[model samples]
Target chain A: MQIVVDLTRCQGYAQCVFLSPDVFQLHGQEGLLYAPSVPEDQVQRVRQAVAACPVQAILAGEEVAAGGG
Target chain B: MAGELRDGRIVVVGASLAGLRAAETLREEGFTGSLTVVGDEPYPPYDRPPLSKQVLIGGVPADTTGLPTRRDPDADWRLGVAATGLDLLERRVLLADGESLPYDRVLIATGTRARPWPDAGEAALDGVFTLRTRDDASGLAERLDAGPGRVLVIGAGFTGSEIASACRERGLDVTVAERGPAPLVGALGGTLSQLAAVMHRGHGVDLRCGVTVTALLGDGNERFVGADLSDGTRVEADVCVVALGAVRNVEWLADSGLAAGARGIACDAGCRAFNMYGIVTDDVFVAGDVSRFPHPLFGYQMLSLEHWGNAVAQAEVAAHNMINPGPLQRPHLAVPTFWSTQFGLNIKSVGVPTYSDHVVIAQGSLEARRLAVVYGYRGRVTAAVTVDMAKSLDYYRHLIETAAPFPPPPGAADRAIAADVPIPSDVPDPKGLSHEPVVALTGHLPDRRLMVVQPTR
Candidate 1:
């Protein structure tokens, strides 16, 4: 599974960090630094993180099928 | 019905505190269907109350002010986009990005934006600021931390007074200029406002009343340096904060055909949005600062409240009605309540004090800076304002709800002066003392139209 976050929409509420610390982290004072992709085993955590975000800035989905390549 | 039934989608515009809370309540009420929330700001929903207080004082970081949610409603959030229009017949919300989201029901919680200085270029100056969003608070906090020599705050509304209070608390020199006869004249009437002026001056605020800022002067580098008052007084300051009240976020609804304008999105008692022709739509609802709903207690006068408590309560009511049937639904009739902490004073108000014609001291004394002023109209208790005596406000709120008599039942301890001692004074207009009250009695209607209509000959 892959998680995508629009940086501009992130307010550093840290709810994502609270839900999935390994996937999302706060960087500096205002920036929200987070991993864009996660392993299948951690997909649930990523989903929880997306759900917990107050601004709803995080999104998780299946990786694009590897057929085009 | 016990399981997740696939009901039609519910779309909430504004993604504000009220909108988000309503969405959560819909799920809690077992409305299992698609949900979409749209917000103009890029960021997700966050708390706004702190932006004016703790955020400005740097006690709480701006970005970290997001409100804690009990549970997450997994729904599509359309951020960085705005709802441009509403098609009631088609049941679709037109987005600025050209995408239209269909909904079985829609909620409008497009709150309000901070009123900016009249001069666009002058307001754009580096040192000129208005506190509303997280970005605004963060930027202003940063400026305050830089130790500006002097801070000039225009208008003594709650936001303006709080900003001045924050500056003074930081040991910085500050000045507050109010066009009204006194600070908070719009909300608390003139007598209490006079007390506010005294408090501000006692705290070294250099309070200036009955004057207007004609022009904002800028330094050679284009940063706000001073302000020219209408009375020919040029006050030098490194920074200026404009707190001219708020402008309801209803412009996008202009073309939506809904009766949305500067006041707000007009709605019926059931929270259903009304059209230009005064027709109400069931599928569409409005809550929070964006909603102008009629209150039965205030003689069915349509009130547009910007209070925090009203937003939460109205959102919950809007949410329940969105999912439940009509019989089980209820009106959002919670008495309007708001509190402000400034200059070491905790000011709380219940009901619409400005909507009343008379005010009397129900408890404590104004001289001691601890009192509750009960407002009345035609002998019925209309509203109450408390300064450092908030506990008594709850009782007065009940009095207002029950339409208790003016000069209400005597204080509990019998400490108050004769009931007639605290006579009602004229509620001054925000524009100036010469004008009438800003919150006028529109007479048993949701819109100002009915109040203005003259009877046929």
Candidate 2:
């Protein structure tokens, strides 16, 4: 699975960080520090993080690689 | 536009967070239909929570905070237009432009607007501002950058406190006045609010609790200069921000006869709106800050929440129901979760604090500005609040979800010693609060919108 965050839309609400800490983290007061892709076992957590985002900034799917990976 | 056509035409009002999400969900849930979205704001859907924090402090651009769409909703957006009425018999949405959009189903996600100061003349003062729209934040940020001598904030709710926190972060002198005894008393109860009061004072915020700003004073040019307080004291500040809660955007639904009121348009657990006579409407649904729905955990009281999570959660549930049959429809039962960062502390809460009768410090201590307080009612855990202890919030959330016993059993904590003494939760009467609850239990307040209901009056 692939993870993508639209920096323009993210207001640093940190909803994604709380829901999927291993995949997304709040690096102090700077912003989110997250992995762009994760193993299949972590797909469920990544999807949950995407849905929980207030601004819908997080996107997770196989498209990250297919869109000219 | 992405989903296959499996159904009919759908209209979503208020092109903000909830409306945008619902439009997407309808497609994601296999609803193949033409969707139209109407919004009063000129811009496309944008993020608002940052208006008080980052935007005010110059960390982020005000006008550029647009929300990202995961997948195209393929919605025809009627921007800069308001929906005037809902003609149920004809199944059409009347717009301000005199055009009506016919729909098989409609979603109301109108959300809310900031409550302005009572006096129109006072509100017109040049330095007076209300933070709700991006424009408001951009204007205020420009003023803050000019290095005002002092900033007077008229409330101490989450938004108010966040603004003050931003002002302090910029090294500006700030004064906060609240009618309650302490900051955040209305939402987190007395004990926790006390910590908030101390944190503000410690961070050099001139916090005045148990007092209200009686009148806003201005100069000959109608520029705000100071404020007169109920405590017989006057605060001299060049810029005054009215952080007095919000007015649910339900005025357009006034004649819709869909159980709409100041408390907000009433909806059931499935996000189905109710009519004036208390009958649920099938074709009409409500979500976001505008909808008031009953929650079983909170004794079936209708909750009107302005939290970002509730808006997203309820929208998903409402959209799923809009596209599915009765047997497959899911209920909106997500536990309320809220978080705020101010005064250099990370505050987090889960469940409804107002629904509890007793509160105990399950972990940490207030003096340190780091603690987790668990709330219980009738021997069952109802809520949990943590300040600078964000990690432990989920632990307490577990207790509330399972209806754990009050004064939770010894050794429930990871600490050697835990403070579990029961005390009155001390949730204030919402009527006396100058600010609205970010997540409100509507039954307690005498009025919903703080301003005049009718202009003729």
Candidate 3:
């Protein structure tokens, strides 16, 4: 699955990080850092991260190769 | 019946603390149906109470403000996409990303946003800030740690007052400008606001009352430098915090045809959203700061509360009713409760004090800086506000709920005071001292706009 985040709206609440640390991370000064895509097996964890965000800033979806890779 | 219940789908917009709790409660109530939660921001649900206090004071790290959840509800979370509209007829929610989610039941818990500075250019300046989210606190905390020359805070609402308190706690020079005659007049009424003003002044706050910020000044690089007040006074400061108040997140529901606006989405006593025509739907419910519900204790007045306790309690009620049958449905009638720590005093309020016409010292003495002031309307207790006397709040809260007499029952022997304590006439208007009563009795206006819609022949 693919994850997309809008940095401007991301408040670094770290709720996503707490729910799915494997997918979402926090950088220095608690800035938001996350993986854009993950294997299918991790889809459930990624979805949990998305639901736990306070500001509701995380997005996830099925992976799709660009231009028919 | 179990299969039907399991087949139902519930969708909650606004992944706020209230929204998340409601979602958790739904499952706990044996809701095995599919659940979908939609939010505009990219991050998931997190705690907000600490953002203004502990996060600002640097006691707790900003990134660690996520609400402690006992367990996770496996649900589809559509984040980073705004819920643009609700199709009540179709039982679907339209997303900004061109996605539509169908649901059997919907919960509208979208909360409020900070009211930003009116001026675009000035608000865009570097040092201007508003505390509502974790990022806001982190940025402001960083600036405070950098030690600005002076911090100017406009508006003395709870959020504004807390920011100023944190500033003083950090030993940074701070100035507070309030448009109302006294600080917190909009929420607590005039008498308590005066005490709040005194508290702020006693703590060395450059407190200015009855003044509005006219303009914010910026340097050549468009960084905030100072501000100009309506009183024709120019003040120089390194940072400015606009804490005007909150704007309800109802614009997204504009096309949804729900009774949503600046006041918030109007809901029935049971938390059911009312359509534009005033019709209530069983499938759609609302909770938290976003939902304007009528309080029976306050003469069924529509109240939009920003209290933390109200949010959690109302969400649980809304969630329980959403799944339970009619006989088991209950109203969210919890007495409003909120507290603030400012200038070395703990201030707490029970009930809507603004709805009262008079305030009397019920216990303790104002001079002692520890007392409970009971607000009354026509001899009936309507609200209570306390300064460093929170332990007495629960008792007062019962008085408010029971519509107890104004003088109130005698306190414990240890806390007994003169029953005829002075009732000051210095209450200020929320709009301003020159304005009329802070709480107005506006007659009901039926959803006339909704009435105009004719059902298909």
Question: What are the per-model C-alpha RMSD values against the true structure?
Answer: 9.3, 6.5, 9.5
What digit string (tens of lDDT, one per residue) describes model 1 on residues B238-288? 989988888888877766778776778888888988887789877789999
B1-457 in candidate 2: lDDT tens per residue? 1222347899999888799779888878777678888898888777787677767766566865666565777778888889999999899999999999999889999999999999999999999999999889999999999999999999899999999988998999999999988888888998899899988999899999889899999998999999999989999999999999999998887777788888899999999999887899988999999999998888788998877878888999999988876777788988888777787776778899988888988877886667788889999989988776665666777787788888876544454244558889999888888898877786545566353333212
Q: Write down the TM-score of every candidate.
A: 0.82, 0.86, 0.82
Candidate 3, residues B199-272, lDDT tens digits: the string is 78887889888788888998999899999988999989999988877778988777777878667888888889
Put down candidate 2 lDDT per residue, A27-67, tens digits, no spaces.
33524545654657777888888888887877664320111
For residues A1-69, what per-residue lDDT tens digits would candidate 3 score against the true structure?
555553323545677887777766553334344555455777888788778777676655432111110
Show model 1 residue runs off by greater than 4 Å. A1-69, B1-6, B433-457
Q: Which candidate is the best by lDDT?
A: 2
For model 2, which pairs clash?
Answer: B6-B32
- Give the C-alpha miss distance for residue B293 in model 2, angstroms: 0.8
**Distance from true location, Cα of B23 in model 3, Å:** 0.6
What local lDDT does model 3 show for residue B347? 75
Query: In angstroms, how far off is B117's CA in candidate 1?
Result: 1.2
Task: Give each prediction's DockQ, rounded to 2 decimals.
Answer: 0.03, 0.08, 0.03
Please state the CAPRI-style docking class of candidate 3: incorrect
